[model samples]
Target chain A: MADRPPVRDWATDFDHTDPTWVADPYPIWDELRQACPVAHSDRYGGAWLPTRHADVAAIAYDTDDFTSRSVVVTEYRPPNLAPRGIAPPITSDPPFHQGARRMLLPLMSPQVIAKWEPSTREYCQSLVHELAGREVVDAATEYAQHIPVRVIARMLGFPEDDADRFRGFVHHVLEDVTLPLELRLPGMQELFEYLRDQVKDHIDNPRDDLTTALLNADMGGEVADLSHVGGTIALLLLAGIDTTWSAIGASIWHLASHPEDRDRLVKEPDLLPTAVEEFLRAYAPVTMARLVKHDMDWHGCPMKEDDWILLSFPAANRDPEFFVDPDEVIIDRTDNRHAAFGLGIHRCAGSHLARMELRVALEVFLDAFPVFHLDDPAAVKWSAGQVRGPRTLPVHIG
Target chain B: MVKIAIDSERCEGHGRCYSLAPKLVEPDDLGNGRVIGDGTVPADQEDNARQAEGNCPERAVLLEET
Candidate 1:
């Protein structure tokens, strides 16, 4: 066999099996990004890394050249996912992809997202208020975790009571990386069944929510069928809930660590918008993967078909070439153009909704508890892989 | 002075501009484009408005010199 690319020992130890890497993989990320910006790994069975910011951004936007098929990490790839992998619409190349995006675009219009802002703000305030006067509280469990799931539940026309249930299901899918295939398959089935039933209910009643919208959405003069609805819901749940939770938690962690930035925002409340952008750039919560559609050269590397290319959003956000002093959390950093929400066709559909939730969450929390501080930084925990964020952020609010 | 205006017809309702520059742009109750602050175009916010235009995924926002 030809010489294999050097694999990091940590990749073998942690790869997809180890739970330790989920806790805090930044050190490993730094090492990989520095040592091999385009390194391949044996543990992942020939997965290519694009650690630099520009490379990741280029690959993410170049859906025509570097397709989104098989976007899931090797660790998270399910057998059934392959059939739908990189297919038309979401995973497909342009022309069709453009139309698909357009079809779904109306559902996430600013007005629709803005209507949910009140609910999002109320939820965030309640979570923060519940933890008030307490020395320690799990910020992730109480705050970050609630926003996206709750918003999604409302959008999907599911009862607010189902938020915890759906959150549990999503958590199982994301965290249970090491579970047997048999066990893992059931989780997907359970979530699919739940969503399927939810869609059926919408079809029967036909409310004015997102489920209803999707069910009625005409894709070339035909309503979205079960599979399309199911896939869209799954995509929204995964993208809307988990990614937002990670970003909210990560933002809190960054604010806690950088008291100066936090204090500055609190002092000048007008800077909250800029502060939001800075937080997104400073701690992007998602790492993306795309499959090379056909054999094409990328940066002197012969990226072949089906080659899994990873996009490091956080790394790209911090690239000095893109942002000056990218490491610093300058709340009012002008000329900030980070790919936190990504770019091009596959750019997040729910980004506007996500931003509304984030901005409102930050605004409410800062206004409500300007003097809050972390009870213990060490108590905060993190999870990695496709989604990265604090597991628990303990804080004291007076 | 330069100001940004969102084309409601071509907006596609993506909301990228609103997210990028919420201070100057907001959606109505139905999520249609609505300029914040009576379209005055605050002096300090010109840059944000321009950035929103440049970053708009749909190119729905238009900047006009006054």
Candidate 2:
């Protein structure tokens, strides 16, 4: 008998995709949370809006109740790309999801990640050293972008020379929306083809690398085939490159804007690890989605099946309920159980590897250049959608 | 006197600690190591532990006084 509240239309032209919103969606997210943490959206074809931390976390881990298969926006899938609608396994519920995750877990283990630290650290240091005497340099393009792609390329046993090309392909695949479907499809096709060829080579050679590992991995009863290898590669490339790139740029931006925090880090380098956790909590790069499997009551709101829910981890990390003084970046703040890497079954598989890269990179940067500052904070540009990061960070090093 | 402890639940078996301080840590069949032997803190070994901790990809190992 009660009139329904006005639905939040997220897919409209007037939606929160404006330049300012793209740069920072937290204020808009905060507003949405206050208005209706579980409001429906007409634009997303009547998907539920879960803006609060607790609501998002609950949905993310409740695999039985909220499944991943139905969460992906089938309508949003660009034409010419492979069908992402074949849910139930890649985006499936329980048992199936658990099996896939368990199979891929070994590839992301701490031992596998540790082997790449030296190279990751070296790559970061080399980038810094290259810009040592320069008065101004694009931190995002030069350092953040370079480190992760290279590390990923090496892990997959791709040649170092292919790093730049692969980076370009990934950037276009994920970022270039202006291009026609004709162009986009080819880009996706090229990437998939390249991966397929590499996977084939690795399968034939059986090298002791990630590509080979994925090729050879037994998904228990099901053997990982080319499509499986392709999917895994695509996941790693997108995750390894985009997430770390965003975090590094965001971390540097935060440090540059807050000189006092930088000074504290310089004074006490021991806080780098904790600082990394805090940074991740503050600036999580990934925004995940989940789908309600059955009609259920959440936070007193009735929700139907097949409703898409977006979990904004950044918003959750800054939730006052879980973090004390969540807005302020407390470098040494321990007890950080932030879900920057989403919790439970679908948690970021590369979290340890990401931590090692971030820690080593920050450590080497602080050690090598103690008194550097941003050349022009205003010039820092940010990428939009799914992943967020400074497009360019020009810094002046001493 | 001092000792080292590794929480297996937390450990991803990175083996970086053993690589850093072989004398103090040894790896099991799964490459996960336990701190079984005494770690002689020769004045400079503090730096080694610090590096080991810093280099540890997983925050699995804890060094404490016995």
Candidate 3:
């Protein structure tokens, strides 16, 4: 992470990487929603943060005004890579977006994702089993972090032991966005190199996994190109890891702190599904970004072409206008039309897979511990960037 | 009596409708919501149908009273 000045005013100068925003951003977002619904910053070369659900949704849906050329706010603005940007679908726009997205949607749909549940559950159970006799456990590292890495690795047919390298890739792409182009570009290059190697391996072996599926994926009667395959693989690997990892870690962190929710869930196991949704709504892990297509007045904020729009679904989920008692985490709360996964075209392709991982991880953890709490409240450290969650979560299970 | 319909144009496959009311709606190959069996909601399952309609983030789920 790069060092920078602390945020003076969240409304005028909001930096997502700022310690104030990273530590506890809900209050900052709450204040911004009322005072400045769309906050602007000179950091990251003129970025705008839209705190309202309507604004964020409008931006997400308006493919015409905001381009998905680059979803990450970094010093280096990726050259116009629309339709099939650095990562397809997630970074693609309009007609091109739908096709690229459709190719992968079936692979992640509920029915398809359902088949992985058994394996995911087994993996989670094994993780829990490892921590059986431990009095204190780092859920983030030991339990929550490993689940997604293992699952995604198996799906991609990559070496499962290379989890550390994947985390390094995640940190560079997501957490280290504030770094200079010289530093950031190399990390991205390394990631692509890794994907290329994996793609080569899949080609040689032709195994049953996402890499093979993507390589052989049809693009309107034409096979997807090499770069597209590698990019899509990059998307699957990078997107799948930290986002779900954060969701699982945050959910466990919540349970560790809030025994009431934990006990309720432990007693009535059926409530886990609803509670999972609630956790996603309240502590939604992913916040996406978009680049302004043309200079235009956006809700009184003078936005320039190529200005970064932090399309914060997290902020949108907490918008009082959209959610009842927006800040409160009600386990069984229905009518939760939250934009946790996002809205419109670019809804997380791996949402079903993520949901499965989260539900299973929580289920295994609660079943193993039954009763747990934060070992040290002050010790929990949240990762600073778009994907926010506790990186180091210490809990006492005994 | 009520019948359910999903606007394909609006449905982005969030799976909320199908998740909430599986009997009334189900996900297609692409995970978009599809009304099951003539899209009709039984008297007993009307609440589930309505819940699905209201909870759809895209507002794609439609319930028509007949």
In order, what lDDT does every prediction score?
A: 0.70, 0.68, 0.90
- Best-fitting candidate, measured by TM-score? 3
Stretch of 10 with least lDDT, candidate 3 chain A? A74-83
Least accurate 10 contiguous residues by lDDT in model 3 chain B:
B49-58
User: Model 2: per-residue lDDT, tens digit, A1-398?
Assistant: 11223324533222222366666677666666666655565434445656677877777757677766633332243222222323213454566565565667777766667788877888888888898888777878988888888888888888878887787776765556434456667777788778778877887788878878777676767775567567777777766787788888888888877888888999988878778878988888777667666888877767777666666777787777667887788887645657777755566767767778888877877777777678886788888555678888987775
User: How is the predicted docking of candidate 2 categorized under the CAPRI scheme?
Assistant: incorrect
What's the lDDT for residue A297 in model 2? 84
| Alpha-carbon runs more than 4 Å astray in model 2 | A1-16, A44-46, A70-92, A176-184, A294-306, B1-66
**Per-residue alpha-carbon lDDT of model 3 for A1-398, expressed as tens digits?**
66798888887788998887788999999999998889999888899999999999999899999998998888768888767998998989888887898788877889988988999999999989899899999999999999999999998899999999999999889998888988887888899889889899888899788889888877777778998878888998999899999999999999999999999999999989889999999999999999999999987889899999999999999999999999999999978888899999998999999998999999999998999999999999998889989999999997
State the lDDT at B34 in candidate 3: 85
lDDT by residue for model 1 (A199-265), tens = 8888789998888888778776777557766777777776777788888888777776777877888
The number of clashing residue pairs in model 2 is 3
What's the residue-level lDDT of A337 in candidate 1?
A: 66
Question: Which candidate should be chosen as best, given DockQ against the real structure?
Answer: 3
How far in Å is the alpha carbon of A3 misplaced in model 3?
1.7
Docking class of 1: incorrect
